[model samples]
Target: MTLLSMYFLAGVLAVSALAVDFAYLLSARNQLQVAADAAAHAALYYREQHDAEDAKVKAVAIANHSMPEDSYGAVLRAEDIEFGHWDYDSQTFTVDDFSKDAVRVRPGRTETRGNPVAAHLFAILNKPMWDMTAQAVFVVFDPHCLREGFVGDKVVDIQSNNGYEKGFCVHSNQYVSVNSNNTFEAGTVVSMPDSDEIELPRSGFESNAGLQAALRNGYYRLRILNQMDRIYEDLYWASGDFLPDYIASAVPITVSQKKLTNADLIPERVHRVNCGGQALQIEAGTLLHRVVVVTDCAIRFGAGVILDEAVIITQSTDAKSINSASDLQIGRDDACADGGGAQIITYGGLEVPAALKFFGGQVIAKGNVSFSADAGGIEGASVIAGGTISGTSNMTMGYCGTGMDDNFTVPYFRLAF
Candidate 1:
């Protein structure tokens, strides 16, 4: 009976030891997963501005920082980091040396790496040592609104005689209200939270061709204006200004007393103007090229003003933060020129001119956007507003993917494993 009790005690101790080893294995796996996730995210971010080789180096550094080599012994190797494209529909990742869309990181504490997790009970039982690896796939994507379209947070109300070109997208967080005699070309997308929630006239379907077929139901509640602060801060720092109020306290930029012209601005330098609650009115035929203008007041453009490779930002919340009277051209010509486009970011509403032409340009407003006249011609035109997008008769716009480099795109990251 005493020998039987001793055998039972030995069995119990063996089971307890196995259980402890299992728990330790789980803890080690969690640590490796954390390190891999961090490494993948850091690599993807670095790949935005660098090549795959540089990105791999960055990943190894980040992984080693999380798991020291002396303790974990090379959990993540530079060769194990891969740049690739992740297909959402297929749920697969394909390796691509030149792709910056996704990054895959494999971190392990395995026998091959000479750091296999020790298993005392398993070794005593004549079992294999613990060999584990953690995989992380991090991806980056741009929002549809920034891709090329008109996105309104509140409502999108369009009047009669409006024409949208191919690939032109219109989305509203709430609803879209449209009047009669409108044409939405093929490949155009009009989206909202609910397709049935769109407001239309009695003969909406019959009056507008492709309107019924173009309606899509989706939800995108991106706070796009929040990005303006980062852009503003970046421009401020790039201008070599240490103080936030340095540009705010400076004198107003003018050419002839109250007016501004080509001579008033230097294309190579960043110009900051303190309007002091007044307007910064540009003279007629003023050609602003390769410059950045940051101001706190409204901007009024004279007739026939042109912008090429330029950026105009206003922090005003007035009714017309950026207003044009006669006409405004946003590029060098009809064909898109490399490094020749313009972008306008305003905190208030945008009052578009009679003929708003765009070879490649973007208008981002924190408030509403009122198109008083026709806006067509060329390509690469995007209008994003936080409020409503109303007014307009006979409006047309195009999308040029490569020509929109001057425009800003919102980026986001996610971890998929």
Candidate 2:
């Protein structure tokens, strides 16, 4: 009986050891997995705001924080982090030197030398060490050109009964509301990143193949738009020696009286064009050659206002209207090589007449941009607005597709699968 009791006691000790050791190992594995997941997510977000190397560093740091040194038998290291893309078909990951879309992280592993988790009880069974490894993968998503046409940062309201034509990408940052009777052409996609307040007809707003093809193939990204201030100055505006230091502070120059003289333009200073809070009206058939500036005042382009590679900027604090901005022959004869295209930047809303027609140019504005059907619509033009972009009557405009560098970039990064 004494011998039997001693054997029973030995068996009890082994069971207790197994229970404790197994629980510890399970808990440690869960912790490592959590760390890996966290690291992958952080890496993707960091890649969005910065370059690739920085993103890897960010991921490693986040993973290390989750599984601190000595928290487990092994420590998370930078070598455990990897950048790559995933193959969904094969369910595999391939490392790449140039890809910023995917990030992989391994929190803790016995693969590292001198870093094996020591088993407290399992050693009695000729197993003194255990290896633990956990991994996670995350991918990033980006949009292409045919995916955008009218992108508003705040609000978008379209009540046009005539509908939208093909080859136009419409995306908004806030909400998109399309009223009744407004149809859509083939290859036309209307997307909003923030709210799901999209109101459009499902069964063919216009009943065309082009519009339907766009809807079937295109995708949407719900995120904040990237800033385009630098692109506006560098790509769209005058560059190199033609780039000015600053336009001096001067009263508004008007062809209202006569053609602008040399006194109207300040040579060698191109960055600043200052109109001292006064309205500027370019008389009918007047020719403009340099960048023009206006501050909190109306800008009226009279009949046949011809621009010889000119750019105009109007900034306003109050809500004032831009009167009779019509009948302009801008950047047509020069072939748009000097600056690629004539440009217009406005801070306030534009109230244009029916005869508005712009050729080979672009408009970047902070307020609503509206065009009328009384005259011809835009041709080879890219118009960007901070608010609504609409026209009261049905009009035709050809924006088909511009260079990606031409559009304002709103960098949005997100996890893909």
Q: Summarize candidate 1's per-residue lDDT along 246-304 as a digit string, tens digits.
A: 23323333333346788888755567777788899988899988767777879999988
Worst 10 residues of 1 by lDDT: 240-249
User: Which regions of candidate 2 fall more than 4 Å away from where they truly are?
Assistant: 1-59, 64-110, 113-147, 161-163, 173-175, 179-181, 193-269, 280-315, 320-324, 328-343, 355-363, 373-376, 379-384, 397-399, 402-404
- Report the lDDT tens digits of candidate 2 across residue range 309-340: 45655555333435555566544433223333
lDDT of 1 at 348: 95
At residue 114, candidate 2 shows an lDDT of 54
On a 0 to 1 TM-score scale, where does candidate 2 land against the true structure?
Answer: 0.58
What is the clash count of model 1? 1
Candidate 1: C-alpha lDDT = 0.79
- Sum up the clashes in candidate 2: 14
